[model samples]
Target: MNKSRNWPVAVIVLLAIGLAGMAYQHFKFGEERKDFERRWNLTAAQLHNLSIVSDVPSDINFIPAKEGSGYVQLSGKLKSEIVRKLSQTEPASDGLQLDLSSDSFSIFSFDFRSTKSQITVALPEGLELGRFQLDLKSGGGSVRGVRAGQADLKTSSGRLVVSDVKAAQINLHSSSGKITAEQLEGTLTAATSSGGMSLTRISGDGTYTLSSGHLNGTGITGHVAIQTSSGDVTLSQFSGSGQIASSSGSITLSGQRSDSLNITARSGNVKLSKDDAFRGIYNLRTSSGSIHAPDSPGQTHDVIEVRTRSGNITIR
Candidate 1:
């Protein structure tokens, strides 16, 4: 009984001690944090090829440089002693090639101050790179208004925003935090393990995977392969052939697809909007749920196949 009665006192003493220690440390280190930052800049011959590989978790900005500047510039402030990166020209046949990475001695660190740093890369207007590759971690940011032959951007634990990226092949991957992309081209490959994904005006052949969050798309074109588990799948203005599989969440689509499509839902309702552009042979099946569709193929070679285990299928 005595020990139990004294537990609260012990906890209060420990908390007081911890707070006092923190106060002392703050008094000693407050000024050092202000001096932790330094400005840096690097220049390259051209802005045709670029690679950004960072693990320090900072917001990255891609902006237009001065016209005919004949150089790409990297300007940012180092926010911590361990947050140091350098850009160097890479070997290439034509155009400029630059790679930004951590300095040799400070390749990777767990310094918390580095997470809130910022980086900016400036390129000439109307610049299109041969390849744009960025592999970053957390503290999400935006990458916009650039064209590339191929683009691969990945992040986690923070919102990733992309816009006006025209690439031949594009892959956006994130494990957590929301992802928003728009006005993108190429054969897109987008996936999120546990967070929502939103796309607008995405065209060309594409594939999407959402493990346990909402997946939404608008103005999608070409062939697509989408799969979701325990997350809702919603699409609009979709065109061309595609396949979709939903494990346990709702699937809703409104499109102008007249090609072959195969869809399967384990336990989620599937809904297709009634449109004159949706002409196909309907073959809807379900195990223990209702289906509302045409009994015949509607005299079209295009097949729209749907199967569900215990969910309703709606086609009108």
Candidate 2:
């Protein structure tokens, strides 16, 4: 009888131990999901500009709100301690600024560390903005459906994407990250140190400069000027004039409408497509490579010049 009673107690003790072990494991390795949301009712007439500054890794998305007055919504997942410090906003006479720095003692001390966080911001739709600026240090982000008078986007080491932007002027600068923009209707000025750039369906003039990456564009409506140090260039379906230069990469252009086309390459091939609608005076020359301009149109006032130091030129 003692053994039987002891067996029951022993079984109970074993079960308790197992339960405790399971609880400990769950506490140590279970997922932690923390989220926070904040909303700001902004006066659209008073607020003309919006700026976002961050130092941590974040993915920012901007969507047009359907209802209500102009407002700003910020929602993200981060540590509770970090979330407490995210409430940094300043309203000036001209615009609203949101700074999401992860440094705790930023005012009185110096700390260059940032916690891992994901942030998303949504802006009101149909609100006319005078200026929109996004300055990020090390996070990948995207901006969409923004209609501003002027937009400037800069990032240090993350990819940047902009789409459906309607601005009078748009400037994008990136260091060590790729940049992509589509459906843009403005004068674009883009520069990158170590990343490729791609633009599509652009409606205005553009000036692109790259140090060590490719430049690609399609369906451009206005004048375009491209300069690359060590990367290739490819343009298709261009409707305006163009001036392209490359140091150590090939250049290829295919279009049927242009007032003038000029290309200069140092050590790469240059190719152009000619059609029945092409009307320009051909000036193709190369120092050490062959020059083939088979379909040079009848003499015209417009000029199509292609020059290369040590690469072939083909006009087909």
TM-score of each: 0.77, 0.80
**Candidate 1 C-alpha lDDT tens digits along 9-109:** 99999999977976766524221322233222323433455676654455555667655443344444433333332322343444433333344342332
Question: What's the distance in Å from true for residue 69, model 2?
Answer: 1.3
Q: Candidate 2, which segments miss by more than 4 Å at Cα?
A: 1-34, 59-62, 79-82, 88-90, 104-126
Give candidate 1's total backbone clashes.
Answer: 0
Model 2 lDDT, full chain set: 0.78
The global Cα lDDT (0 to 1) of model 1 is: 0.71
Error of 2 at 93 (Å): 3.7
Name the 10 consecutive residues with the lowest summed lDDT in model 2.
106-115
Clashing pairs in 1: none
Clashes of each: 0, 0
lDDT values for all models: 0.71, 0.78
Highest-lDDT candidate = 2
lDDT of 2 by residue, 1-316 (tens): 4678698889999999977876766533222325767776667754588887876555555566566556666666544444665555546667777776545433322222333444343456556688888887777677777778999988899988888888999999999899998999999999999999998899999999999999888887898899999999998887888799999999998874775888999999998877557666788889999988765565678888889999999878
